[model samples]
Target: MRRATTVKFKYRPHPKQLQAHRAQVDELLYGGAAGGGKSMFARAEAILLCLRVPGVRVLILRKTFKQMESSVLPKLLEEIPEELAKFHASRYEFTFKNGSVIQLGYLDKDGDLENYQGPEYQLVIFEEASQFPENHYSYLESRLRASGEVAERMEALGLFPRRILTANPTGIGLMWLKRRFVDPYPPEKVWRPKPSEEDPEPGTRVYIPARATDNPSLNKDYLKTLNRLPEDLRRALRDGDWSVLDGVRFSSWRENKHVLKPELFPISLLSGRKVIAVDYGHEAPFAAVWLCKLGNGLIIQYREAYAKGLTPVQQAELIRDLSKDEEEASGEPIEVVADPAMWSRQDAGAHKTKDGSPPVGSQAHAYQTVLNRRPIKANNSRIPGWALLDEKLRIREDGEPRFLVYNTCRDTIRTLPTLPRSKTNPEDLDTSAEDHLADAIRYGVMHLEGKFSNLDGLDDYVDTMDPMETYRIAQAEF
Candidate 1:
């Protein structure tokens, strides 16, 4: 028989951590700048609960198992003395001598929620909680349940089932987290809470802010790294400023300058080439945006249509109808530019059209057959496309932005301001966001080829040189 040995672990809490550790709230958040020991607090809190309350189940998680191993596993191991707590490697769980369990899990995707349905955890710790969606947080908290003696012991211990969320001030969940917990409440202030429509969990919740300075022992190099981040990121990780709003890319978007109400729009001013931009999706979302670029480089995004599960033929017909009014109002011929993927040939199963003939496998072919117009393949460069979108969002000294969206394009207007920046490449939009409208806008704007930009000065170079030389210089300037 193996002998049982107990190893003790000790942890000293910083002031912010202590506030969170002592919180009697149903949901507690200890978040702010990086190097604030945000993650360390979650680890210590999990261990303490398991040790004090026998048979208590503590679940500590990050967004992915890879994140758990890389960020939490090493520190967690040092805190575990491995005494009588037998760790099951496959389960990624620790079964303490007193029947308590601490399980390390990852909620990588929404589908992973099913794995946790049966476990009634008493304490749930979200490490870097900002990386998760609000729905994930709510779903997990709903699973915080216990019955019988385990519940009695928990009651006696004065430990009601609770959730501890630790994060820096950034990620996809930034806005929701800020709205739910961070912004309304001041640091260290607890609320005697009531249920709200957005967050109906009944219990007190509090925000205890953490800063890099809070952890005197946090590495100088890590602090230096945080300081070196971009202005918004630096403010978030170093100063812990929630007002900076990190996830959104289009901070320059102003409603007055960019939105054109149907009654206010001057449809008669649209005298240049009109374009219908498309992004094709069958199971996901398909989007088409109608745009009219004026000769003065002004671009008006006048209309849009977005939906999912539509065949290419259906999409083409929808686009035709959506653009009919605008084309007639402006008395301008409209050209079509579609996503490059729309031209790809499909297999035998691709024919989704009613006719027994070939499936409308290629969206461009379908457009040609039905609308009698083949769409020009759009420029698909993501980075440059996003830059072009940024150019449109920029407001001039006249307080008029080059890009204007009609109030009719509700999806485009709604999705643009709420799109989160990609964590992997901060410069890009998070692809997981509902970005079909943005994609359609990108396809259209990129196809305009920067002709409507502030590059009209290039025409002057032509007058100073020979015809051939001037054309060469103009192309170079362009």
Candidate 2:
């Protein structure tokens, strides 16, 4: 048997992974929350085993190169002595003088693992496994079968090991992981803690839970940063709790300043192309927002939220009056952007005429047409509209964000946080919540992406179309 290294390094492991690692258990899993030393635990185990085996080949897989370069490589170099840390710059692998080789690899695409199809390793570590889809992990796992005496050594060591994974939970499908790992399972003698539920053909796998508090040497600056966050964000980042509010979008987007109010756009002073975003409602409020492009930027200059108790004609009049006022003040006609379903289409229940127009067309069209003979475009495409808004709201240099809210737009400021999900079963921001004003802003900005006559051609280089369409068009070219 190969002799274990007598060298000792100054390092500490998390209590949870430490207990499991010290045991004769085979496989182990350490997960949950940010700031936890989950990644460090995997590294410690890999190094210790490599030293004992002398030339024990280990494989460490990361989802991205950036993560490996900044995190895994730095810590591994810091832990092992300089003499043993022989660098392989060309292959991105590290070899220790003791004959242990720790190979660094990535799996951004599942096919990327074909190069290691025939390889075998005593240790395999996966960092941020959740970032990759489930299929990628399954493919890489097949390559974990180690042969020869090392396999017997693993059995004698009582290590139930096969593969390991670590990651912070995000988006949907995470609930499935929580149920499988976070929630307790029935105990079994073979897989006592029930970490090997997915091992159908038998063999050992285990999951160990961990959090940021597990690391003893965490910096005070990181703690201070956690403390300063809003209540919900603080919980997600520090507590590692998976809980969240259902209606909020852009939960991670934040500001260091106090809440500002919306401002009104005077028809006389307003310049450039004007537009409005509308969120139509049957039982809810018929909300609309007036938006204007200033120089190279966009702002939600005015917002109004009203219930649908009024007829479509009433809504049209309201929109017409608002448009006339803005046009007279700004010397530019206000082009109102509405739901695509509301225009150039038959009413939901109305009969269509020979010309294809509805016998009883949308009351929405009636109201909007009163303002201008030509209909302003309606954006029903979620992907495109979202990109348009994102481009407009993006902040420029000097620390200023691209989008701004007027002080007078109270309803928009109040309800933006409450928008519903775009999809019925999705976990993302609905994009339809108290979103009438936001929708208006999106349409206006997208309309301007095509062409702008008023500029000194400064923003002329800007494409006046939805960037999502651009991506989709590019994707089709492939």
Candidate 3:
């Protein structure tokens, strides 16, 4: 048996892995295709960091205990020589002779994060990071800290309080992970948010993309397995494509193509039909969208309102308030559409219908009591609604996507891109995610079901109420 020297760890990094090893961002994601050596890079980094800093604390996590055992632990054990460290099976931790320790943990459910609330670790690494929720990743970042001697040791190398996340672009956390790391800029470059970004957390983050071909040592048959997956899944796992998520209904959505600023949207230019679409909720988010159906076959979400714990009356008042600008802009009455469930009868908690006694009525009745405007029941047909929404995302002849969301409509922009198609019925949205805003968008698009669907009349269908286009055409003839 060979005793370890001061630097006994032996490893050779491929070009892509070397980039992961060298990135100095506070947050780093080594992501992409499965065989990109993401897992191996995590293992090597943990070993090299732990081996370098005596008394250092490193915490590596997976979404489940099974994953901790199957994917992380075995390979980690193979990396660290026996004499340099002592592995505790019960604790799932390694203690080095130099007083450094590496803890292995799992974040499987909502309560699992509580296990880590009290601890501090200089380095926190998430294996298959996309499997955990954004909150889990976010909350754990607070735990990345060191003090006293460990801080002194880590700071010397400028390596204190760092995060390493490895993912394959498909998981519960895929949207947030992709949004935070992948979407902000070009890949393989360090990204820092400007002051105007939604999350302008000043810390530097980098996304290092990798694929199976980057590792020559990888088994050739793994590529075959990746190749056999469905197109969306294969694109995520085999091609390192962040754009396509498995079962994501709206793969056509691109922030650059669809989400527009005020300069590009030109809100003052709309003289078209408008509709106020609402998906009502009390404890959950009450979501609404002011959809402007413009003369040029462009659909823009001009205004958005979202809040939790608002009563039906409050939501109704909110609708009127949100509609005033669009109504004034279009110089016409805006149509109001709401969830069909609003019409369902509810228990009369306080007031009477007409007499003094308590009476059962619908939320819609309460809502109309405040605004005096009855909301039309939107078509709740899931397939056709999603289909209409999907079609609106297409690029028109003008080189802009027909469906455009204002940069200020943050909730719609946030949740719209994350709606994945259901596994049971691929045509419908998976209702598990935060889909209230998307529901509102769907209702708004479905309201335009007849117009602009077939290409024969898309350009031909001008705003019936707005005579501006007619005036422009007549003026051109003179």
Candidate 4:
């Protein structure tokens, strides 16, 4: 490596920024909204540090290679004048006259960290640190080393190498970083906390608020672009506030427009060819509801739910009662579907009735026994179930909602929309919240859509004849 020569460009730092640059702080976080000279500050600090220490090497990291090429790379070239631009572009590096060098790199993924393991740096910079996973930061920390001559000099002063991070507050690691740096001390002493019970780890982490007002030199065109953004996005960008992105999922939902007076749904839809779907839960309330489509319309009329958590036998009794109500009122064909997992030969446990019958059967014989006596069946697959429900909720050409909810099924109605995405996976939301009713509805739709069976003449025969008669006729034909 070639020795870097010392060079300095005059800079006028504000009181707060000057304090940030001069401090003996080990870890520094200059963060917040756009137009905050945070990025410029970070780059200037790196340049100043190299000037301070001869032959010093600095590593400036961004979240991705594209980011390095786009923001960091272009900004560095633009800020450093032609006289100092003698830096090596091919190596993604800059060399100062004093022998100090600055390298620009990106940590795009976990694997990217390994490339930096052996390289030693007197200073490290993480731009947009919030975009990275916590583990990536943790992994990089282990590689923080000031070896040989740098270590000897630092050892004498009792100061280790330092890191600077800048980012707007948003990401999966937001909670961890907030707890550690933003506020290490708890507000209430009585509220005992875990992780580090005492003071935070003896690591340096600082958070500085930066806004458009902090950077007066912002380009007028850029400011105009920021002004043109939509209200929420403009607020988030200009004020560094966190808000939800819309039009992807649950964007059209409005509480006032969707919520209506609570009451029982009409019986005409429920009485004719009904499907009862159930999602069983022991801790929370067990949910089972009656639903049927209105003609070919997407309106979903949910008749009722089997009220509370009950033993398996009691749930069975409840199902029988609801079945009788449907038979008497609508006299329409009825079918029931539940989670297939529930049909596994598992212990009914304390869910047994006074007669000692388990809510679920532990033996295959028991499942068969339930089949012989009840009007219920367990759905074997959920993907198909969800597809059925999705198909029925299609947005019509007229532009109304694809599905309508009757006021009667309040529990299902309230919960179907609030489910949050799974922390581990972004593709699917955690179905835990109002998932019971949703799953039950999914199964009910699947059962109605004839997805459960692929028999050639099954739908034609069922539409014309009773299932009992069709069963006898099929058996006779075989």
Name the best candidate (by TM-score): 3
- The 0-to-1 C-alpha lDDT of every candidate, in the order given, reads 0.78, 0.58, 0.79, 0.60
Error of 1 at 461 (Å): 23
- 1-478: candidate 3 lDDT, tens digit per residue: 9875664667888999998999988899996888998888888888888888898888999999998989788887888888789899988899998888899999998899899988789889999898988888988878988899888888898875789999988877788887888766778989787766755566788999999999988999999999999887888899877767767878788777888787865768866777888898999998998888877667888789999999888888888876676667666667777887887765635443453211236777766676566667776655545656766787667777888888888777667777887776665678987899999888787675543223243223332423344334422321
The runs of at least 3 residues in candidate 1 whose Cα sits more than 4 Å from the true structure, single-residue gaps closed, are: 1-7, 196-201, 245-247, 250-478
Q: Residue 178 in model 2: shift from native, Å?
A: 2.9
| Model 2 error, position 78 (Å) | 2.0
TM-score ranking from best to worst? 3, 1, 4, 2
Between the candidate structures 2 and 3, which one is better when assessed by lDDT? 3
For lDDT, the strongest prediction is 3
Q: What does the lDDT come to for candidate 4?
A: 0.60
Stronger candidate by TM-score (1 vs 2): 1
TM-score to native of every candidate shown: 0.55, 0.48, 0.71, 0.50
Residue-level lDDT of model 4, residues 41-144, one tens digit each, is: 88988877766666677899988899899999887777666555456878899887667788999988788888898878878888988787778876766667
Q: How do all the candidates rank in terms of lDDT, highest first? A: 3, 1, 4, 2
| Model 2: residue 63 alpha-carbon error in angstroms | 1.3
Give the TM-score comparing model 2 with the true structure, all chains together: 0.48
lDDT by residue (164-264, candidate 2, tens digit) is 66756543324334443443332222354423657545545455655667666778678778778777666656765543323345343233221234323
For candidate 3, the lDDT comes to 0.79
Relative to the true structure, candidate 3 reaches a TM of 0.71
